[model samples]
Target chain A: MSSSSAAPTAKPPMRDALVAAAFRLFLDRGYEQTTVDDIVALAGVGRRSFFRYFPSKEDVVFPDHERCLTDMTAFLAGGEDEEHDPVARVCDAARMVLRMYAENPTFSVQRYRLTRRVPGLRAYELSVVWRYERALAEYLRSRFAGQTDGTLRADVIAAAVVAAHNNALRSWLRSDGEGDAGTLVDHALGHVQRAFGRPADAPVRAVPVRALPDEGDERPEDVVVLVSRRDAPVWRVVQEWEAALGRA
Target chain B: MSSSSAAPTAKPPMRDALVAAAFRLFLDRGYEQTTVDDIVALAGVGRRSFFRYFPSKEDVVFPDHERCLTDMTAFLAGGEDEEHDPVARVCDAARMVLRMYAENPTFSVQRYRLTRRVPGLRAYELSVVWRYERALAEYLRSRFAGQTDGTLRADVIAAAVVAAHNNALRSWLRSDGEGDAGTLVDHALGHVQRAFGRPADAPVRAVPVRALPDEGDERPEDVVVLVSRRDAPVWRVVQEWEAALGRA
Candidate 1:
């Protein structure tokens, strides 16, 4: 506990040492079975050093996510490139997250399995993912500050970005991180960007009604009554309604 | 402890009695301070009856969600209405969940407050919400079984529906459930139905690129060369790309 001398230059830092030792023991013994004392003893460090690196054992399981979130926040804040579309920027930020996991295939896969097996760790992981979603939402909120129900827009787009990224990340992780994580995330984020991207002056051809904000809140409710033959096919009735509504 | 005498007709069932007892004790004595014995004693029930009703203390915090999930499943399975758009059907299902919360505003608000104060309860609530999300995803998956990337579509839409519903639900809850929860959820789910409602033959008007499946996975990456003057604004450059892509 008294040794303050730095380790040799070839050695990993005390933080990485703690994480490595913790995961090693966590994999050997179950997460609940391993203790802080065991991690520090195996890492050849003090309990104080372990506490210095991680707040708790669960923190050790997810060491890189905070740094990734910080990087995403900083990337989203670097808005000097005013030309960048907000949706595109958020998608790029989401890619940075995917890249972080793709960087360490072995560790990422191990952590994924560990998280799935532990209920506490699974809840902790959801909280972390929620923070990432919040970051994306905050950035989008800043960009869409002027729009109606912009908060709602920001929340939906952020959830879509996180959900899509997660969908792809889980797929790649399940495959033991062998395939292109980038491609999966890109495909997923494309859905978000296309759904929320550009519309005002240059609307795309198939979604004229998508860009309108929720102005229906102020309008009185309309109950449409469609009169059709009872034996008419449902699709035919729907077709008639769609034609009447200019949606066919 | 063996009381064969039934309660009067005016009395609630033993299950409701347990929930009321648990919440009363949790709010008065704090969740950590209250025990199963305290709850059973407050409800004038035997220890065995408390265990029979709820498996754990956390289970008492969310008494109705399991039944609600079952009911949602039943409502969804009653889908012989082939005319119903899956997106619309799921949106209706989301409305049922909102109605559940709206029906009992006072108890819902008290529960919301209790959940926010207890970390364990909050995590449990997240798990319950996750189950709801899975149910929506399963229904969407069944409806979209044959389409390409149907699973991806199902997952994204499910998350979006849940997120949007939560957004509006929380807003209403924050107001102490005084306002109309239905309108808020309707406005939110409109975003989902618009982005994904009917695409192939009946695309509305603007969003030509939004409906295509992730077919680009098999195709070589698209590299569009947009030749614009060096001084052109970024929007102008983007415009050229959009023009060439036929998305404008």
Candidate 2:
């Protein structure tokens, strides 16, 4: 490799330089036509440097995914607390993926276009997406372990999160990353959250997700059923609750 | 080249013969070691016959997926009426894939084992799965074209159906294709239906998410009741319960 072109590599990280050079050649020539040797030569780096940054040519086309997937796994694992609604937590995890793309609109849009035309790259991208779905599923499965149809629920919700995020993310990329991706993704993930998230007034709230610190555990007297008269107005019950609690 | 051996090709369909021979060779030898020539020779068929039935060596390992994907697309498209719940329709569409695998349990089990060993085959299987998911998504997009977040909802539900179906299907396959695959897949797909399918008597509510009041979609006597621990701070329960009642 020539030392003349190597000056730029010292400025931008060698990894970024390799990606930049690889994309330049891929766009100029084709993905298949651009060899690793050609990329390293253009980037003024050794073959070892190229391999160090990315395992393969296809990976260069979509860098940062490994890091993003790691971040997503960590984000999902961080939601270990029972109160963090699992479905909503997964939806939020999917949002981190969107942010990865949204953070680099131009590069992501470019990569999206490139990945579409190449069948091998498209398949590779699908595999990467599958890994992300699996991560979310693993997290959800642990959370829903004992529930009826737990594994199915976990897999379905995980796939739903990825699908919703990708649908909106792809739309944004198709438009050249022109719109508000957060709103679009949130709108999409909202469907999954509501469809799978626990009900706000779930009567099985004996161990409510939002239980107060004061309520250590349920006791005999904790079953306070006011059994309001069926005909009683809602406001009257509210008043009785207020009075019974000595808060009136 | 022997006429006596070639006679068998005329007896069995060339496609089935090719698949049977390919798998036998794949197991006896290795997938990479067994080439198209080896399969054709074992099947007592010519290269032309093998190529006519399967597009490539990898295609032989997954002989039924193309036909299954086409059938799935057609099945999804046939659900044209508005009365049909799109989510449930897609779930049924995924069941067609399970039936295809379950129809030939031994072959399905063998293929699943082979696929897990080969990275290329796994990626190919994933691509085939991706096509099935896309078909469902397309049908859903059309069915939910104008509704709020229709595209997002369609995509999410479609992926959920595919994920849930595959989760159960793989579990059955992993068990050496034991037990009833239909029952297992049905249980898994049931999650998708319950999560995303519109209720049979669903009213025209703008948001058809979870109406978690059991059969009572909108009960007039819906009330919130919170029972604090006897020794608990009453103010905490009062405040939190007020917030909960406010939502009700």
Candidate 3:
């Protein structure tokens, strides 16, 4: 048996064939009803070969996610060498996923449809998506370390990035990948950038302060003006105020 | 057999005993090694009674998440009756999960430790958390339906709320729930509220804008002053400008 197996060494093509055969079987027979034997028989491979390529039947549906995740991590690591913004780097990492799906439209669309039908697969996909989000968050956490509200900012921005990326990805999947996925992802990601990203040369606009008309001759002797970025947390403003008061 | 099974009709104590017995068995003999039969035998209950309370052994560890999820959903539903802000409503819903954990500190902390050690349980917990986030996002989607960037706002805010809640919950759990969980949750949630929530009577502060010094004495006849909310989307600002130009 060992001698026989030596001739049919499991190569990349063999793995690809097994994955295609497994997906075909899953689509025809349904994910739950399909057995490992069915997949192996269709691929003309032994059970050992099937296990070598995929740990389980469900693993076949998402064969490339492990590679995709590794590639994303590498992309994020490479970004640290440049003068890139952390949020933009994370968005770029998410775009890698879009490129992967766009590369294989038919398989991606079919997998999306199949996953929507299977609760287990949906949960598995959610977990996978979460790992991607955590990678982004960890990267941002390092970038934002020592700043006030850094951890909260990291987690919130990571979640928002993932949500925005999924919004675009799901929209493309829903359309059967008919439109330009890159454009959809860019549009969706733009919302996050506008909300959180700070451009290097963003202009400061002056907002006019209007005072209420004085009621009769009881005029105020002094007027105190307060200003802050619309999105600044109250705690941060309070901290700034305390620092200034301490200086005084 | 049916008549005999009626003797141990699953009461609250039975469920509690089953959970306690399962956790003890899991600790003594690893989670992978512990069998349903072992749990039933340890608890001195029949297999049918064990299955009646839990669908599987893993379910024993996360016995109350289903109930907590239901309670959270119901709270969100009830909030719609009052004219509550959506972000505040979501934060209150998240507090429900904290209350569940706070109500059973030992079990919650034990489960958290167990889940951190077990990969499968961690994935299950992630899926459960995703469900909670989705429910919050759906509620926000309805509340912000007609506003600009409503869907994006709904998803981002929902994700932020969940992230903030989890940040506080995990901190308390890491400390073994010894401190005031409510105070920690409130402090974490305040970051989100300040970033996204609309206070009942939030003031619109007048920001005094300083004009840039002219490099050359090219005094323009007209000084165009444009003011918009800092957080408004660029497309919205453009639309407002277009509308104003059309009016002019």
Candidate 4:
């Protein structure tokens, strides 16, 4: 209710101040003990200002998530390239959030610890994560609309992208955000991409196909065979067929 | 606060009474409007009994999820069968939850609608879903321990299973819990099994080898190559390979 604190109601400065003050209080006095009054007083802002920036004490803890989710949705939405692999595109969209976490390693790590300790905040974080996953799924579902098991493929790939992203993100957070999160996320996404990417076309190109000539005129066409390790990516098989049709 | 209400402190009856009363009040007067005292008074149970059964008003709205999650964890933990396909094992485990929802269609549907309206409850439900997914992931990771990309594969498969199950479950609930959820879930899980099952090992086995035929090699080993549509299930490919191998 202070007049001087209310003077600077212009967003970024006041919002950032409240967030800084809130996190400091959350770290020093713990999340439950820290009140809105405490955050506003520390930030030299009014209660109204705090409310303007964040609706609740819990909201202050996760200030960037809304923006991050919006950014991710936009990333997925803008992906209209015909040649872009849906799986890879989704994984790239997931990386947008990872980049958000990577931008503020210290704050992200601190928030991660706080959220883990507070059940309500943890639940809120899960909801946010779900939103990101849904955005990815919706995009993939549109791309795979009429294909066989398209819906299943969309849901699974989306879930896989989210899981892989979190696996990397959580691993980094568990290490107190010490390592290269970009690399971890890339490595994680790579696993998903190889497993479920482009059906079977891309990977099949990497495998060598043989045209073995047949002896008898009755069986005049050459026998085309592909021999790969038992664990080759599905794409390798898919690509070979595409190649076979092209040759025929 | 009434003495008559405080008379019956026996656990199970008291807990069930509280849940029943709370739901009735929640339906009649909305969740936020109904207080703990109102619930206890209606149930004819002590406030202590209400607290014992549920920690909060939000907890009452979601009475069975905790028990269901625990049951799912137990189901996954008991997977000692070497003969069961890991993917099928998980699909069966997911069925336990579907059965829980199917047992009380109206209640489940009501809860689903309520959760969609309430942000906090939706968040709580997401957390519960995450726990279910974690249980599935843990079971799969244990089964695929040393294989390449085992952890990623396990996590992805678990996520896919959970996603597919939810897709079916939600579609059923969206129809006001009409139709057979069991059949819907079976169809959904069938999609997942077809895409990622291990009937012929993983999807990596169909890569081609570079075998240009020697011009004079007469009637060289009959190159038995099985060609199927690119969209064929991994299991079908594996079965075909198995049958081919058998014939050979």
Considering only N, C-alpha and C atoms within 3 Å, which residue pairs clash in candidate 3? none
Error of model 4, residue A151, in angstroms: 4.0
Once fitted onto the true fold, the runs of candidate 3 whose alpha carbons sit more than 4 angstroms away are A1-11, A205-248, B1-11, B205-248
lDDT of 3 by residue, A7-81 (tens): 454337888899899899888989999999998899999999989878877788888777778878887877774
Q: What's the CA error at residue B206 for candidate 2, in Å?
A: 14
Q: Which of 3 and 4 is the better model by lDDT?
A: 4
What's the residue-level lDDT of A144 in candidate 2?
93
lDDT of 4 by residue, B1-248 (tens): 11222346422677777878888888888877889999999988888988878888888887767777776777777785676688888888888889878978998998888888877788778877888888888888888988976777788889989999998998899999999999999999987786677664434233233345689976443333455443445556545544554455
User: Candidate 1: which pairs clash?
Assistant: A204-B206, A204-B207, A205-B205, A206-B206, A206-B207, A207-B205, A207-B206, A207-B207, A208-B206
Q: lDDT tens digits, residues A160-185, model 1?
A: 88888998999999999988999999
**What lDDT tens digits, residue by residue, belong to model 2 across residues A100-123?**
788789888888888999998999
Of candidate 1 chain B, the 10-residue stretch with the lowest lDDT total is: B202-211
C-alpha local distance difference test of each model: 0.75, 0.77, 0.75, 0.77
Q: Point out the worst 10-residue segment of candidate 2 chain B by lDDT.
A: B202-211
Measured as a fraction from 0 to 1, the native contacts recovered by model 4 come to 0.42
* lDDT of residue B205 for candidate 3: 29
Q: Which docking class does model 1 fall in?
A: incorrect
